[model samples]
Target: AQSVTQLDSQVPVFEEAPVELRCNYSSSVSVYLFWYVQYPNQGLQLLLKYLSGSTLVESINGFEAEFNKSQTSFHLRKPSVHISDTAEYFCAVSDQSNYGGSQGNLIFGKGTKLSVKP
Candidate 1:
């Protein structure tokens, strides 16, 4: 089984300031990591993912995350944030070894609320 943990429940930052959302995971088997963001009154959208090969992944936006296997962490970061970036961020992990059952099922952490203020 795989599980994710978000270190902070809420992160408040000023617009244009750098921010990081910490995420950690534990798994008995190989896993894939993902960051999902949900804007106000919107559904969850895939932000970035680390399946294999490269350890770092970036979203279409300015956000980027590095998959550190040794640390068991995939922390999301941005050099500068905007008011539009305010949202609930979730860290999820999928068991890559499990292909037959619950194919798309992912274990998720309690979301972190990112609040960007002016």
Candidate 2:
């Protein structure tokens, strides 16, 4: 069994401030970790992912997350955030198991609502 836990339900930051969204997971086997962002009234978008290879993965939008297997944590961070960066962020995990012959479902955290202020 695998599960993700977001330590914070909400984070408030001023514009151009550094921010970090914490995430931790527990699983018996190896897993893939991801961060997704959902803008107001829109669908979720992939922010970054850690599948294999390098433990440090980055997104084009100045966000980075490092996969720490020993800690079972994949924390998302950005040096400076903009007002537009405010959104609901979700942390998800998926194992290699394909349930019912379908793609394995992603277990997601409750999400952290990032509120960027002016």
Candidate 3:
């Protein structure tokens, strides 16, 4: 079975602080990694993804993560954060074999709560 695991359930931080959310996965076959963010009362938005070619992937809003095949991990990091970044983050995985001509079924972790204070 392909599954994703998020190490942190909640992370609290002051405004303009740095943060990281850890993620790991176990799968028998190839997989794709993704980080998604969801603000209160909103849908999840794609933060970043590790599809291929690069071990390190970054989001447009200053977050980055590295895919480690050996360890089956992909951890998210941001040098500095804002109160606006307060949201819930989820790590997801989709097995390549399941990608049947479209976005495959996404298996999400329990989720990580990121609280940025002011």
Q: Candidate 3, overall lDDT?
A: 0.92
lDDT of 3 by residue, 1-118 (tens): 7999999999999888889899999999889899999999999999998888989999889999999999999999999999889999999998777745218889999999999988
Backbone collision count in every prediction?
0, 0, 0
Q: Per-model C-alpha lDDT, please?
A: 0.94, 0.94, 0.92
* Residue 92 local lDDT, model 2: 94
Give the clashing pairs for model 2.
none
Best candidate (score: TM-score)? 1
TM for every model, in the order presented, reads: 0.96, 0.94, 0.94
Pairwise TM-score winner, candidates 1 and 2: 1
Q: Sum up the clashes in candidate 3.
A: 0
Candidate 1 lDDT: 0.94
Q: What are the root-mean-square deviations of the candidates from the true structure over C-alphas?
A: 1.5, 2.0, 1.3
